[model samples]
Target chain A: MLELVSQMFSYGFLNRALLVGTLVALCAALLGVSLVLKRYSMIGDGLSHVGFGALSVAMAMQLAPLAVAAPVVVLAAFLLLRISENSRIKGDAAIALIASSSLAIGVIVTSLTSGMNTDVYGYLFGSILAMGAGDVAASVVLSAAVLVLFVLFYNKIFAITFDEAFAQATGVNARGYNLLIALLTAVTIVVGMRIMGAMLISSLIIFPALTAMRVCRSFKGVVITSALVSVVCFFCGMVASFAFSTPAGASIVVANLSAFLLFALVGALRGKLPG
Target chain B: MALISCKGVSLRYENRLAVEDASFEIEAGDYVCIVGENGSGKSTLLKGLLGLKSPDAGSISYGDGLEQRMIGYLPQQTVVQKDFPASVYEVVLSGCLNRRGMRPFYSPAERQIAGRNIERLSIGGLRKKSYRDLSGGQQQRVLLARALCATEKLLLLDEPVTGLDPVVTAELYALIRQLNREGVTVVMVSHDIVCAVHNAGKILHMGTGVLFYGRAEDYPDSEVGRRFLGGDHHA
Candidate 1:
């Protein structure tokens, strides 16, 4: 295991995967806390589906997949919010509608294009080859932007998440914060899809957040814990995948799932103990 | 001058009217309770005063230095709010967001206000406790502390006590009453007409019309108030 681990880090592709994976894990986890509390966590899934469809189209058009997918996914997120608010469909239902349609579009487009892209399997599942040098640089910049914005608006975000109506009443501009959340979630989902695969990216957004909640009693604690847990889980899962020849994305999700179960048990045990 | 005055206000949720042609005045330092049955627009009227909802027909004017963001608001019970992941201190300090403007962090003055409010509400011990795990009364106290951090001039509470045992309800009422006595002008919405009559200096009864709006003592003697309260005066 030590030999395999040491050899794995020697490959530049594996090194890039670890770098972007850790960055995205941190970004997704930070945004996940707010999205989960707002009951908008599924937006990650919906946006990932939108991103998959956009990526397929971008590939077909011979364009940069990330460049095309980011804006389209962001727009889809805002559209989802509007549809949920202004139409008869609620948030979850809107997500399902858009997500399913985008998934179908991605599949249909992928089949029609029939491009000799070897990375389709990687895109569908997960692959260490997903992270190239350009992708790593872009991921770093995007992840840093997410972190800076989150810190800058931390107080406003807390105010809106707790009680949007109250926040708006107190001149907090609830709509603006909601938009910020949507934008950040959209960007994180798009970036995370590269490493986690479109099918499994939302787990990165969700698992760390829910897991952190079991042990964390405050918003700040949950955010910090989630960031740390997500990065650590990504590394562990990636290492395990290399050792066991398993799918990278699934391995990471399984790692997150195990951590969640462990924390839940700990939380339950703590609950049973007398204060 | 009155702190706030509403003239022929009509508030709506979509096309349905929540408050219709309502008119009233709240003077500085007044402890007003809006009493009404469900769907009678007590909440809507409060929203109109807080500038959340626009009056379709009338105008709401502010005086005595009241602005849209300066007033503290305690919203009614919501399942989403109850499940929020925050400490008691975080929740209380969030009330200072209005004063924060476009700044990124809370100022020392805001933090001091939050600290004082927590002490004032006697929830200093629960400052680090998770908000969701708290009992109903304790949660209300935390929210009350949050509202206090927002404003000392005026506080608006929508159904401040919806569910709680008799003891907790009485305790919350005492805390709110004490705050009012300390000169924080309060406008609360409650279904408990008895407490509204008991604790409030003025009663704003909202219904199909502006049924009664005056001193608490005058409500029972008024024709509409007697019909609305069903002649029950038990406190």
Candidate 2:
């Protein structure tokens, strides 16, 4: 076990994957608390599906994946917001409409190519070995930007998420902050989908936030605890992946799930949760 | 001059007239209560006053040193909004966001304002508690504290005591009365005409238009007031 662990660490690919994985995990957790509280958690899922569709098209057209997928996902997030705001279709229904359509487009593109690229499959379910040096750098830069933006507008975002109408009444631009959150979610979703898989990245966003909420009562407490839990979960999941040869994304999700269950039990025993 | 004035103001929901040709004046330090039936455009008029929505025909203007920053608002909370996962402290501090301007972090003066409001509302102990875990009464108190932190002059409350029990409602009304006595101008929308008339200096009753806008004591003799609050005087 020790030999295998050291060998995994010796490889540069594994080290880069862990670094980017931890960064993306932290960003997702920070943004997740706000998104989950605002009932916008599914935006992550929808954006990931859109990212997948864009990536598949990028692959088919022989374009750089991140360059193509990032802008496309951001645009999709904006479109989703507009549809939910202007039309009769509400948030979740609009997400479903966009997500399923994008997923279908991805599937159709993959089949049309008739060459099921292993690399594309890796993105579908996440592959640690598939993260190149460029993917690591791009992910780190974009994820760091997301983290910085969240911190800069932390209080404003809290105000918007907790009570948007009141926030607007008090001269805070709720729509602008909401749009910023949407953009950040889009960025996090695209970057995370590359490593966490399009199918399961939302668990990374949702699980840590929820687990922290079970125990932490305050928003600040929840955010701080969620960041801690997400980083630790990423580390443990990577270790598990190395040890047990499980998939990285699934392993991390399982780690987060275990943490949530443990916190739920502890919260129940402590009577922290109200009936 | 009136702190806020609405002249022939009207509001619409999806191009259909909801509030038509309504006009009223909120003078400085006056507690004005607006009462009406369920869909009587009381809230829509309040929204017009707050500039949350644009008036279709008339102009609503602010005066007597009330600008965008000088007005505080407490919106009616829906079920989902009530379950928001914020602390009393965080929620209160956010009221000072208008004063924050372009600063990324909250200044110490804002913190002082939040602390003062928290102490004023007697929610100091619950400052760190989750907003969702508090009782409905406690949540309203926190929200009031938040509104207090926003502005020292005018407060606009929309059905602020909608779901609270009778005892809590009384307490909230008493708190509002104290603020009004301290010279904080107030404008509120309510279904509880009885209690609203009891505390408010003036009453604005609307059905389709400006039914009655006069002193609370004179509302009983007015034609619209007679139809609305005929026998029931207290809530």
Candidate 3:
């Protein structure tokens, strides 16, 4: 196993995949903290579908999928945010609407071009083994952008996530921060879809945050712990996938779930046991 | 001049008029309590005052240069799920976020202000505790502390004591009266007529309109008061 791991690391493709996957995991974990806290975990699910729909349409038109997917996903996210604020519809219902409709649309569009592209299945379930230099570069850039934005707006975003009305009353534009959050989620979905796939991306956004919340006391603690757990999970998953030739995205999600189950057991035992 | 005045104010949802042509004036430093049954527009009036809802045919004028920051509000105690996982300090500190603008970081001064407000409200010990894990009375106190962080004057409370025990309710009312004595204007909406009559100097009896707007002492004999309080003249 050690020989296999050393040999994998020696390969440039494996090195690049590991780097990109780790960065994406960290960024997603940071955003995931707020997403989970705000009870908008479903937004990641919906936006991933939106990304998939965009990819299908782009494939039909012979365009770069990311170029098509990014803007469409962002616009869908913006609309979802606006609709959620309308007072007529509940927030969770709005997310449900976006999620179901986008997934249906993606399926229909992909079916329409089924015979044209044989590579569509890889997009649906991810193909990290096929990740090239360009994909790695794109992943790095998108992750860096997400990291910088989170750093710059950490306090404001924290305020919005906790109590939007209070944030607004104090003079922070809660609406603007909310919209920015949706945009960030969209970007994350589009970038992460290549590694986790559209179907399994929400787990990548949820599990680490859940693990962090189980063990951490403060918001900053959650963020740091979540990022650490995500990086560790990504590397373990990558190594498992390489050794057993398993699916990369599924492996990562399974690794995260395993960590979550371990943490949950510990937490339950701690609750029952005397200090 | 009144600090806030509403003239011919009316609000409706669909074809039903929630408040019909209600008119009143509230001066600074006045402790006005609005008493009414559910659906009598007590909350609607507060919303109108906060500009959350626009009256169909009324004008509301604020005192000159009174920024929104001058008004503090404690909304009704909502039953948040127990798994929300936010600390009492984090929730209270959100009040300072408004004053901090869109800046990415909280200044030491802002943190100090939030800390002071939490300490002043006597929830300083619970600052690190999860908001969801706190009892109902404790949650109300934390929310009140958050509102205080926004402003030192012009407090507005909407059904602020719904689920609390009577002891906690009385203590909260005492806190409000103490703050009012310090020159913080207060307007509260409550369904507890007995408590309202005792605490409020000015009473606004609202039922589909401005039935009576005067001192609490004058309410027992008023026609609208009779209709609302059951006309028995008993405690």
Candidate 4:
């Protein structure tokens, strides 16, 4: 088992996947707590679809996928937030509208240009070999920035998440912080989409937070637990994917599912115990 | 000078004029209860006073060393807060975010204020407890402490006791009264005119406009106040 683990990391592509995947999972988990609690969990899913559309455009235009996709997804995120806030469209409906439209655009663009090539398949379903050294470098830096920003604005984020109206009343820039959250989620989604796939990236954003919530009670507790859980699940999933020849993204999701169920059981048992 | 003064204020909510031509002033240490029937624009007027919404045709100004952002607000409970994962301390500390400016963290002074409010509200025992796990009454206290951390000058409460039991409701009212006695001006939106009359020194009744705004002692003599107060008795 130890030899198998060491051998898996020996491959440069696998090493890069591990490095980038772990960082992406960490960023996803931190933002997931806020997104899930805010009922904006679908924003991650929506942004991933937008990321898919941008990736198709980038592939067609022969531009760097991350460069094109990142900005495009961020803009789509801002538009999604604006549409939800300004129009009569509810948040979930707005997400659906943008997601379906972007997804259709991605399919059409792919069909017109790449015509369902292997690179497109990798983008849609994710591939372990997709990360180049440059992608890895970008993911690392972007993930670090996400982490730092989250920490720096932790209290304000908590203020808004818990009570946005009260936060606004107290002079916090609730709208600005909300936009910041959307922007960060967009960046995280774009970076994670390479390994987790556009289809599966949001799970990286959602599952760890939900799982942590089953056992943890406080926001700080849930956040810290989510970060740890995400990293651990990614590592185990990667190991399992290498060991059993399963897809990395699916394996990670399954690992998160197991953790969620396990934590739920533990929570139930704790509820039965006397104080 | 009035801490908050409104003149010919009209607020449009959901593309309709919810509050129209409303005029009032809240003096320092005044305990004002805003009472009205459903959709009468009491909440809308409160939002306007908080500067969350702009008046379409009037001016709302803050005076006597009060800034719009410095006013403590305890808004109605939101669905998002029902299952939110937050510690009591964290929620209370967030009240200080308005004073935090560009700092990345809570200052020691901010922490001290949160601690003091926690003690003030007597929720120190639950400081580390998860906010979601707290009961309705305890949650109200925690939020009140949070509001107190925002300012010593004023508090605006929106239906602060809507769902609690009668006992908890009375306790909350008493707590608010105590805060008012300590010189924190309060503007509360209430459906219970009886409780409002009991606790507030002033009443501002709304019915698409300022139906009545004056001293509580004189409320029974005012035409709108007599009707509302008599209606409360019948209900």
Among all candidates shown, the one with the greatest lDDT: 4
Which pairs, if any, clash in model 2?
A: none
lDDT of 4 at B193: 92
lDDT of 1 by residue, B41-148 (tens): 887788888888778898999889888788999998676777777899999999998887899999899989999999998889998999999999999999888888
Model 1 residue A163 lDDT score: 88
**lDDT tens readout by residue for model 2, A96-210:** 9889999899988988995677866886898887678898889989998999999999989888888888888877877888889889988888888877889988888999999
The residue-level lDDT of candidate 4 at B43 comes to 91
Tell me the docking grade of candidate 4: high
**Candidate 3 positional error at B7, Å:** 3.8
Q: What is the lDDT of residue B182 in candidate 2?
A: 94
Q: Can you write out model 4's per-residue Cα lDDT over A68-114, one digit (the tens) per residue?
A: 99999999889887876765768788789889898899889999987
Q: Candidate 2 overall Cα lDDT vs. reference?
A: 0.87
Residue-level lDDT of model 1, residues A194-258, one tens digit each, is 88888999999999989999988998999899999999999999999998889899999999999
Superposed Cα deviation of residue B166, candidate 1 (Å): 1.1
Which wins on lDDT, candidate 2 or candidate 3?
Answer: 2
TM-score of chain A of 2: 0.95
Q: How many residue pairs clash per model?
A: 0, 0, 1, 1
After superposition, which runs of candidate 2 have C-alpha atoms over 4 Å from their true positions? A1-6, A272-275, B232-235
Kindly indicate the candidate among 1 and 4 with the higher lDDT. 4
On residues B69-116, what C-alpha lDDT tens digit does candidate 3 reach at each position? 557778775333346567888777777665765566778887898899
What's the lDDT for residue B182 in model 3? 81
Would you list the rank order by DockQ, best first? Answer: 4, 1, 2, 3
